[model samples]
Target chain A: MVIYGVALLSFCMLVGVFLGDLLGELIGVQANVGGVGIAMLLLILLSNLTSQRFSLAPMTESGIHFWSAMYIPIVVAMAARQNVVAAVSSGWMAIIAGVAAVAASFLLIPVLSKAGRGRPE
Target chain B: MSGDVLARVLTENSLIAAFVVVGALVMVSYWLSARLTRGHIHGSAVAIALGLLLAYAGGVATGGSKGLADIGVFAGIGIMGGAMFRDFAIVATAFGAELEALKKAGLVGALSVVIGVVLSFVVGALVALAFGYTDAVSVSTIGAGAATYIVGPVTGTALGASSEVVALSIAAGLTKSVLVMIGTPLVAGRIGLDNPHSAMIYGGLMGTTSGVAGGLAATDPKLVPYGAMTATFYTGVGCLLAPSVLYLVVRAVL
Candidate 1:
């Protein structure tokens, strides 16, 4: 069952990476574009569309959920690959830029929520 | 001879070794989050902080480019942390976001994605300009990173930015993610972030899924799915816009 989730994710990855590469080519870029994003969308589309039809077993579904929660470890692994020391040693430019962007975005939340206030679900 | 054989075996199965190391690291981070921060700072944020420090230590120790992955037993981290698994994990996160829940996010939830991406990009770009990173490619790549760590590298790669610039972009994105994680709970009360609607808006604006998810988990567990769903959308929006539209905007400014 767990393997099944991996199998499904593998299919999505192949198709998504291909599409992303094609998108890059279409846009004249030399790199893969939106590959992960495309893969994720495909996973969402496939799982939602198929769950009703498949009625997968409870254990199987949990296996899928378990993988979904794998976000933390995988993210840590991704972060581990980065050269943090060098990036920091270069300058404070990146640090300040990132902080400024987040601060501005955080401050905008109050204003943005105003648009949602009237349309409660 | 036995010790040498064991060492060889561990190196041969480096990915397995990486799992062991990372698993322990995550456990310690969670323990720290629970005990040290009293859950105000989520374990995910703590894990990321520890991971970055370890990467730094590894880099300094080996003077290697791949960070911790450069060491013999840790070499598997190179593949474990590569784009394939990163994307796999990211894609899987949206699996539980049933379409019905998505529809409930509504217009403001949708608007947040676009606004968040562009606003973050512009702020990052302005900082880049101010700090002497004036070129369109550098500015936009860093700007895209400010949107999210994922977006930063994607835009940098698409624009063919140098590896150092890409690294810087990623560093910037990581900082944003950590900040959002730590800051969300502290600001939740003042900003009225108790409901699903606002969580979605918050996610869109913040644009780091893990950060938003962790923060919301600390503030209110029920809102995690809503906020995470839209934060995921923000990354998608950022990936698309930062490399193309935002890059052009930066070019015009330059």
Candidate 2:
């Protein structure tokens, strides 16, 4: 049952990556264009469509949910690892950009909070 | 089986082995977070730090481009950790989010996204300039990274910036994400960051979905959905603006 869900995810991923590659080619970029985002959208669409049209087994639904939950941690770990390696080899500019972005966002909080206040709920 | 055959099999299926290693590292990172930070800092952050250390060590050991993947048996990490999976994970998070909740944030939430993207881009661009990155592509790419990690690479790829600049953008975004995860709870009360409306606004302002979600989870689990809702929009908005409007503006300035 869970395997079915993985099958669906894999199918979506395949189509999404295909389209992403196509889009990248069209746009003249040498990379996948939002492949993961497209796959996720496709999964959401298919899941919603199927749930409305036919009943899904509880196991099938849970299977999908399991993958969804595991998605973030795994992806984050991978990306963060790659990013750190890239940043280290790149230069100090990356470090400066990182530190500066954090500091800037922190400072923006007060300004944003002030603007958010006294508004009607 | 012969020893040579076994070695070949392991090398050929090394990616799976990499996954197992990464999973173990994640568990260890969580344990360290629980023991050292008392769960105050999110385990993901710790895991990332440990991952960086491992990556650095792997690079030093192998002197290869793909880090640990260059070690043969860990080659699966390259595919497992690729863009396909990265985007898949991001899109998957949206499945459980309710469309109705997005309406509650209304105009303020919309405005927050605009303000958040522009402010972050400006700050990121300024930082790029400070670092002597005068090119518009580098500046806008880093600026988009400040908007969100996803936006950074998308814009960089579209703009034809170098991979190094894109990597910098991602690092910048990750730093912001970690800080938001850590800072939200400590400043929640002082900044009046309570309730769904405030959470939506906070999410819009912060713009990092994971950071906003993690922070909201720490502040009040109830607020996670609302915050994530707006934060998701923030990513979309950033993606739309970064390569076109923001890139043009940076080009004009520099």
Per-residue CA lDDT of candidate 1, range B38-88, in tens? 976777667766776777788899998777877777888888777666656
Candidate 1 residue B48 C-alpha distance from true site, Å: 2.8
**Model 2 Cα lDDT, one tens digit per residue, B68-87:** 55666666776665645544
RMSD of each: 4.2, 5.4
Could you tell me the lDDT of residue B40 within candidate 1? 68
Off by over 4 Å in 1: A27-38, A50-54, A117-121, B1-3, B38-40, B106-110, B132-145, B148-203, B206-254
CAPRI-style grade of the A/B interface in model 1 = medium
What's model 2's lDDT at B137?
94
The lowest-lDDT stretch of 10 consecutive residues in candidate 2 chain A is A75-84
Each prediction's TM-score versus the true structure = 0.77, 0.68
Worst 10 residues of 1 chain B by lDDT: B213-222
